[model samples]
Target: MTDRKLALAAWESLFRAQHEVFHDMLADFDGTDISQAEYDVMLTVTRSPDMTARLRDITANMLISQPSVSRLVDRMVTNGLVTKCADPDDGRGSLITATDAGARAFRAVATVHGRSIAERMSALDDDELRTLRALSDKLRRS
Candidate 1:
């Protein structure tokens, strides 16, 4: 194949692989208090100190758009999963913190999801996983 064709083929393969893996992993959220998106946001929040993060930071980390993330965070607030407050440092910006309930829910789901991810990814050896991670990071940087 020509270089362009080869690149297209590689992209297609990567996209399909991601879709399949994501679809399978999404099942782990079934019967959980949070959807995949909420879990994603909570994951970032939980990783931060005191389970708090700026809304902009969360938006930066999430794949969703800023408006969508704002709406989602509002829903999460309504569901008692998290709290949204004005950023003390920046009045125009907002801060998000996972509630105790949210933390509990995240922990409950994370245990299962983490294992599921590991099991699914086990098909790739450590070196392959590392290479994949590096390549993904490179792509994101680019």
Candidate 2:
């Protein structure tokens, strides 16, 4: 294959692999209090200090659109998974803080999800995993 064709093939393989892995990982949420989207939001929030994250930061990290994220956060608020408040630093901005219940739910799901990811990635050795991570980061940085 030409260089361009090789790149295309690699891209296609990466896309399909990611799709398959993500589909398999979704099973970790079975019977959980949070959906995958909610978990995505919580992943960012829970990792932040005090389990809080700015709405824009959450949206930036998510694959969802801004409106979708807004709606999701609103629903999360109603479900008592998180609390939303105006950012004290920026009047026009909002902040999201994971509630105690949200943290509990996230932790429960994360254990299974983390294991699932590791199991799936077990096909790659440590060196290969490091290379993959570096390549992925390089692509993102580009």
Model 2 agreement with the true structure over 21-41: per-residue lDDT tens digits: 999888999999999999999
Write out the backbone clash pairs for model 1.
Answer: none
Q: Which ten residues in a row have the lowest lDDT in candidate 2?
A: 1-10
- Model-by-model lDDT, in order? 0.96, 0.96
Candidate 1: count of backbone clashes, pairs at least 3 residues apart or interchain: 0
TM per prediction: 0.96, 0.97
Cα error of candidate 1 at position 124, Å: 0.7
Q: Candidate 1 lDDT, tens digit per residue, 1-142?
A: 5599888999999999999999989899999999999999999999999999999999999999999999999999999999999999998899999999999999999999999999999999999999999999998898
